[model samples]
Target: PAVPAPPVPAPSDREGGRDDDTRDKLKQASAALDRRDFDLAERLANAVINSASPPKQRAAARLIHGQVQCIARNDQEAAQIDLRGLEGFRAMKQRLLNVCRKHGILGR
Candidate 1:
């Protein structure tokens, strides 16, 4: 009998998968923001936003990016992201609302 070739790993199993990679990137971005590294946070969040990530991931990235912009006093840019997409994520939406309120991006 001929030898059979080994089965290839699924996309999600390859090198910890794209979702994992993107998730990790988002976590790093959040950490950078926590560390007060605005530039790195923005870059990392933008990467996630521009990637082929799922809608939830993209929404989270946008929230993080908007928060960074708000912190940097770029209220216009921060307010440009319509957070309605995050309505399903109640906690995240609340956090965004709080951030916007604190930054004056949203009316008190």
Candidate 2:
């Protein structure tokens, strides 16, 4: 008798479905920001920022990542200095602050 072929794995299983979900969530969060839904945007942004994934995808998450850090810095005293020390953060610190200010997520 011929040997049976190995079963193929599903795409979702192979990809873990997490990255796609994160991307979708990030897009929704960005849309919420565009719609001035700061509260929802903040929630979604936090989810993406806190996700256990590589920076490549998270960095592409953009506005959400910014909003999460902005909110964290404003609400968590301990995170302020560390968040400020992030790469390219110091140079664009003022600009980021300005954005957060406009979003009402952070105080100037």
Candidate 3:
């Protein structure tokens, strides 16, 4: 008896799967941040940034990246990220910048 070939995934399905993985990565990065595991968070954020994520997702990833930089006192790198109220993370960007300013890490 001939065995049937396995079904192939549709393009949308593949994209959806990728999206899901991105979401999972974001969640894990956020969790790592919460745990103060900056190394892990940075790695995950880098993965997201290097991926073909939508702008908003990329922004979120950048947010994570920026936070890690700030926590490590790498203000120069943090400020280089163009996180100015775009791509759906406006509040976080503003808040983070404000915190950086208060900490004297970010110059006004």
lDDT of 1 at 91: 78
- RMSD (CA, Å), candidate 1 to true, equals 4.5
TM-score of each: 0.76, 0.53, 0.75
* TM-score, structure 3 vs. true: 0.75
Model 3 C-alpha RMSD to native: 6.6
- Per-residue lDDT tens digits for candidate 3, residues 16-68, read 99999999999999999999999999899889988998877877888787777
Q: Per-candidate RMSD vs. true structure? A: 4.5, 6.2, 6.6
Q: Looking at candidate 3, what is the lDDT of residue 50?
A: 89
- Candidate 1 has what TM-score? 0.76
> Across residues 1-108, which tens digit of lDDT does each residue of candidate 2 receive?
999999996667636788778888888888987786767776776677678756644544444546555554444332344245344544345555566676565564
Error of 1 at 41 (Å): 0.6
Ranking by TM-score: 1, 3, 2
Candidate 1 lDDT trough over 10 residues, lowest sum:
76-85
Alpha carbon lDDT of each predicted model: 0.80, 0.60, 0.78
Tell me the lDDT of model 3 at 1: 100
Where does candidate 1 stray beyond 4 Å? 1-9, 12-16, 82-87
